[model samples]
Target: MLRGQAKGMATLFGQMLPAESSQGAEKAVQWAEVAGRLQSIWTEFQVEQLSKASGEKSHYTDPVKWIATFEAVMRQLPLSNPQVQQGLWDEVIAVLTAVLGQYGMGPRAFEEAKGDPHMPLRDRRFADPEWRSKPIFAVLHQLYLLLSTQVMKHAEAIEDLEPGRKAQLIFAAKTIVDALSPANFPLTNPVALAKANETGGESLIRGFEHMLDDLRKGQLTHTNPAAFKLGENIAVTPGKVVHETDLFQIIQYTPTTDKVLATPLVIFPPWINRFYILDLNAKKSFVRWAVEQGLTVFMVSWKSADASMADLLWDDYIQAQIDAIDHVRERLKVPAVHTIGYCVAGTTLAATLAVLARKGEADKVASATFFTAQVDFEGAGDLKVFVDDQQIETIGQLSPEGYVDGRYLAATFNILRGNDLIWNYVEKNYLKGEEYPAFDLLHWNGDVTNLPARWHRDYLRDLYRDNRLVVADSLSACGVPIDLHRITTPAYVQAGREDHIAPPSSVWKFTHYLSGPQTFLLAGSGHIAGVVNPPSSGKYQYWTNDESPDTLEEFVAGAKEHPGSWWPHWVEWIRALGSDEVSARGKRRPGGRGDKVIEDAPGRYVMTR
Candidate 1:
């Protein structure tokens, strides 16, 4: 059955290159040679591996269920209108006809035939010159484009479906298409085949070894993990832990400037990852930058939780932040401290702010800044696909121990950018047998952290699914009925324009809920790079407007585009909040350590895993 199906597919593919003309005949012969080599190498590896197996049969040739699964799911959704089905069928036939028309053409004619209106966007996966220069590869690329785009296009065309279902369908279809790309398979990947030939099949052997290693490790290798160390290289900023709790440790960074702002800054990074993401290196570190800018910086390093920590709830997380806030205030001898939170930490901080406001202690935080944080999940984008009730329950069941496994969370985020984070590594490490360059960002990304089961479930349900953070009294934190409107503290909201995890529209909704002086800045790039972007690199730009417009589109329309990182702009805004400069702390200790110092920066809590 498998061989017959494979032969049928090969025949259909062969017809897409004419056999009559001499030029077509030449290209067809080249394709056959390539196919023969690929088949030999694949069969050799499979047989060799199968011989050593435990006698359990493997289903390598099973037909792909991506599109079939999509069809099944869509049939159950509200996309069954006859017009929608007809529209999808008409598009599929039109694309198929256009694609098949290039069969009998010569090289130049085939190249020009790409001018058909249905040609997909320039996909970087097939960017190699050989994809166009070689006829078979070009045909494979074009046909793959037709199938993938049609799947996604039909998914988007079901306008009658609910917004949530539509978004889920589009994301699911895209993921399926991305996984089924010809570029992922050695037999279909032109680059992998050429590399195999060049190396006399050694690349395939090395790739097999690499695949085995990744299987043992239980994750794809995106970077050389050994290339970086926490204290020695990546998170090498100078600081000392001032306070510790079961939930978190507070690291007080020694200031770089002689004088520091009177109001110290406390940063609460997402517990899903280490705080070192903000202190990646001296150059890229936002914490280091803030310290150098004459500000006292304290970072909250969240402990990597296990099943023992599973019973912790959203209120517990909020209380932990509250504890950190109070500790920073008392240690610095200040009435209030400026605060910043990234991602989930920012969401919790917003709740803490509401809780503080309800308790009539709003002034404890001098100013608040959010990095790619969303309080409103109403168009939260692809991340929402993982948040429906059934999946949440499944996640709980998977985590019998009390905390959601960090690897599982890592996998969830990886699925969001499958083409980049998942398949790219699969191609490089497992197909090409090449190692990715050492990158601090990828290193930090791979260093995942567990979430307390109760906290994780409540977060997804309350903030993501129910979206109670923005609604008055709909959500509560620290036993206080939470109303984001009561957060009258001065606020600085920054969101990445291209962020997928936290969409700008949802982040912009932070402005709507906060009854405070507000500044909404839109940074370039996705979530991490945008937030960690520093001034010296002089990379992507940011947008700003004098007024926080009601709609994200309106804000974009009236905003001024400024070049380079938004770091300097943020510093200026926070400085204008009017805090005096004071002599830097820790004059007595060797490393400028404060009296309550526990350990060095990038604390032991971060090194847990």
Candidate 2:
């Protein structure tokens, strides 16, 4: 079946090839016509193929089914309400008027209309010169923009719609609008047609091959996967595993200086992903930078969850953190360790600190640092859209292995920024047959870890849905009630200004609960880039305010913006917190002079897919 599909696609490409003797403007028009014909044939072929595979009409392959689903969803909206119906009608009329007016004006008007108010001037998809220069493509683009705008306005205008339903409706409407963009189709996309012409139809042939490969992989290729390797080009920090457990391994890094801080720093990365994000490369590595600052750094590399680990709960993860802290304290003979957590680990770290305070073990962790982690879920960004009761109940059925696959989490995160993360790659990789650049961070993003089903369930219910972690004695971890208010450990909370997973507003809510002195910093980018901004890169800036204001706005009002990475400021803050020096541990022996070493840095556990 696959061979036949490949041959059929090749035969179609053969029909698209231009005679070598033909050249100039005439050839371009001919190629555009060829692309239009291919688009029609491709649609029919796709529908037939999907129908055969499913043994029934496929939802995606059938345009009628897609329209039906969209209509059904829209029908549930309050369109019957007189006010809503009137508002929608007005919006549709306005859209039609704009589109028809533009169509009547024709190509010469579009050239001048580039500066028009309704033009999607900043939108990247229409950046190709042909979209503006060509009449048909320009009109199609304007029509799509006008109609999609009306659909969204209608979705948002639904009177008295519940917030969750409203968000879902807006998202669904957006998904449909984005999917149906004229630029996504070869016939309408001048760039794709030009490439097909330039390659003599070879680009389209390769595009089909790319699509088949992606289908086999069951995910879109965002970056060249062959470009990166763990512990080589990425995650290449020098360290060794000091201890190993069924759940995680502790990696103690090789120090760079003659002396180190007396208090060792242990980092607990989110189990939902590989710990290597902090150690992407020598230049970007937060781990290497800390080691260069003469700090004894240890990282918790979590094991990828499988069916055997599915029974693990919130308490289990919390206990594992405590156990790691204790092991570091006992092995290094230190009274305390500085701790840092990113994303989910940071939330768990807040819980761990509360549990420690409740158990009189708060002194075990001297200082806590959070990177884009939210303890309080109120106003927690778009991720909240997926946390309603219906979705939470279906978490278990997501995987038969009794664990949520890492890919599922990755895809959900991608959906939040679908145009950039999902559709952009689809157009580039499959439609254009182009390989994306070698981005170390994106490569690391693709390497994700599964979540234990029980842990995920408890986390969503107790923290996200119930908002229990903030209230004293309301949430319990490891059989002990944990409260953020009891945590007296000095904290450095860093949030990304553009973070969707953990909104900075929600992150700043730490001020409302923590019974400790806090310094809040806001970085200039989204989740990963914001947190991973290293001093060496001199990239995005970060804002800081010593005054932990009650509101995020007040905090921003009083905040001073710095022009580079926040790492040096954080390192300085770490030093200010009593930086007594100790002789640096021998590098040959990772943990210490006599401590047992499990394996090299990054460890076997983090290397797991």
Candidate 3:
């Protein structure tokens, strides 16, 4: 019997066989169809949509656009160089023939099985000899299936997808090849045929495969899980105690008047992703540098959401962060504190500052920092497409109850880079008999968490869909306008250069609209690595300037040169803004100098949603 997902694929092959090979094609159709459906559905629903939806903007590939893209891909593909393209085509035809021939079938066998019960009713996989293996359905279905498995197994970057919806994406190649009319592609040109054949095969296997690989190695997942292993002064350094919480967390690095005076340090990390990216394994963490430099650092550790805590929203984050700032002031009694925001948290922090500025509380915000945060949604990139009214409505419908299911967020991340996260694992671990390395980062990626649906829905609509923060619209929770110009605070914006989710173009916008003493630093590496960067990593590279440039573009042009760690620079900047005072230290709880401080590294309050 054929696998449930492979029915359509079996039929397509059945149509490829000749009358004489009908029996053979019939025998294989059932099996192949199962594989086909899995791939097709995966692409249609998951890969395409999620990628299109990752940003505030959406980009689509129409049939003509796809054909052009294929031609372009063909133009640049290494396969075209010195017969590599022809070589790939030969390998492709061989693989298809062998896979189908195992059941007494050939390309013609599928044609012969058209009338049979199991085989697809089509004449062949494609009308073209080059595309004789399978139709759009079979090819995409397989691609998606492979991509799905790759992301599921290898991805450590995604924190935005759901399980059930993971099965709905499709990556269709029909439009890409269908545009090759004999006029554009001559049958005589082995190069053209080879290009088509090579591209089709490579794209099916590699695009999704590469996508999965990207996600697996990416930090979104790796950062969360690996930290649990370090018990004490772990080798990796950024783990600094910021605030000793009620749960007995050492709070890493405690703030001191001396620490706050010298540098502008505000730690902002995504609520979905952990805050420790800035404080990951000791040697690589920024928190460690702040402690050494006598600069106080305040990092926000957002708890993972669960069924019990789904009512949290953007406002909750804004308020919690403000409370944290207040707590810092009361303890250390500093007049103001520097703020840093990352990913969504970065956007939230920016909004918080804006709100403060608008409400005449700007004095409380001495400075602000944004780490890969998004403000404007107008051209925010591919993230917008997924939230088309339909998905937004769907998610909103589910949000009234509180938390957005973590599975759903996981699915989104998986879909964003389906090829890497899904197909790569399928090939490497399942088919290739390869073993994944036992990397701590990989372990961290496996750690999944959930978001409240209501909060997420509001976020998508207000921040992304509406562009309320950047556009200066009325986004008041309890009667407060978020004005950027009102913010006279010294500002610094840092971003991960290779961040696909939050690109440089979008992040640079922070310097454009906000009226403040601002500096933008393009950090080295992807999102998480960029933020968690420690000086030990061969000295991190950053694009920054403090010349007081007028615009983001100019700032990038006149940025200063620095080879050492950015942590010291950040620490110095923050410390310069404060005064040296022992009174800033956390009070002796009830006992004496030997009194117990936070009992753990990251406290329980930080872990709770």
Candidate 4:
């Protein structure tokens, strides 16, 4: 009871505080045409093929027969919802056309469903038990039957009534018929699926199923933003309101306090997501691993922005990096330090390196490493396809205050794996009445954060949209010119072959674009798995090629033997720079302007998530 009262008070206090401004120098549109062309083309091609193979005159011409065929298939397959069922029917219908397109649709139209546009929706119906057990293909044919008949009737009605009312009446009829329709497959208990409809439809029901699964699997969280929150530790404290930028800094670790290393390694992670992803937890944390290896590691953890920070642009982040570097150098009494970055954060690092190099301060940056980070995005795989004008518009409209909600960003990721995360949640939480896991990673993932909208918007536009990094016209943190070729820092790039998000092909382009003594290592795992990988358990492998112009093709050519877990290899490479002699203690204060020590391994940020 006491805790609850305190929690409520804390919540109330937090609500009263003002938030940082969102990114405002950008648009708000979300691109819908991303990674959708494949399915779209496939749909068109399949229809033509099916028609040709079925010996039908044309697929669209014989809507009844196709509907019948779909119904037959639905009876055989267990489809989850009407949306899935509808999509299935659409595919089968395309197949019919593809197979039977040799005959002309104009002349060989189905007699029963002639000119009927609304027939399908008006007549479709199915029983719950039987529908759930039905085969996918059988349901398709059944839907085809219902849809064809309705379409035919709608066409007939169109000739008698006015065009506007006729369309409305048809839509109303379709809606009614759709209301009675069961999912192509019967969902035993929706699992995470919705208990009550928000709008309506089988799509919603199926979504519930997916939601359930995601919740149970630790993909989604039910709580508020905690992932990037700071705690009461000097090493994890936000810089005293006096420093340049208030980014939380980590200066010291207790585990390796006895053997302080010479090199200071600070990691700059993307503000697109929370920083804990890199330092997730002990045993699974890369940051923790490095700290154990005796490297003086410091990390910049972004705080969720509020309404007052809308004008913060990408340049602000680069300056933050520079300020962080300056702060760390001042505190550690070191002339320069090693820096590592992941994904978009790496892009910022590259810009920082360029900025520092142009002024002849390149030597201050001892070494640099990019983990699956893309600088040259000429062929940035399909991920870039989504960064269109509309998406920018969406970004503009939604982030009016210039802050991009981390939950919204996470939502986009979940969209890519909708069946596993989003739908699974609906299935479990709302349908099956199951619970989410107590795992830290999932809990952290649920801990939301937001970016200053202007910064994120500029980032997407300049980097993803304009491909500024690839073109070498990237603006520096201080509005000065940047040259990618100026990057002479010893660099190591770690990436995964099967990374759907950052394809090796796209990531390796950094070598071609940047002039640095670089080694590109390709790991054999998906994006998340490859990074968090432990040794000897999985078949993780890597290959490297220090070739020129670092294209995917060039790297593939020089590839040779497979190396085991890359973590050890990285330690060896960086170890060569360290001295075996006893190192001196840090003379300067930390970036946070304090010299206090932290108790926790992952510190406050990890705990926040």
Off by over 4 Å in 4: 1-244, 255-257, 536-539, 546-550, 561-564, 578-581, 584-609
TM-score of candidate 2 on Cα atoms, chains taken together? 0.87
Residue-wise C-alpha lDDT for candidate 3, range 316-342, written one tens digit per residue: 777766777776666555677677777
lDDT of each: 0.79, 0.79, 0.53, 0.56
Error of 1 at 139 (Å): 2.0
Candidate 1 residue pairs in backbone clash: none
> Which runs in model 3 stand beyond 4 Å of their true positions?
1-266, 396-401, 545-565, 579-598, 605-609
> Using TM-score as the measure, what is the rank order of every candidate, best first?
2, 1, 4, 3
Q: Give the winner by lDDT: 1 or 3.
A: 1
Using all chains and alpha carbons, the TM-scores for the candidates as numbered come to 0.84, 0.87, 0.60, 0.62
Residue ranges of candidate 1 with Cα displaced over 4 Å: 1-71, 74-122, 587-596
Per-candidate total of colliding backbone pairs: 0, 0, 115, 134
RMSD of 3: 14.1
| Model 4 backbone overlap count | 134
Candidate 2: C-alpha lDDT: 0.79
TM-score of 3: 0.60
lDDT tens readout by residue for model 4, 107-173: 3343222334312222223222222222342344455555545443543344555543343344334
Best by TM-score: 2
> Comparing 2 and 3 by lDDT, which wins?
2
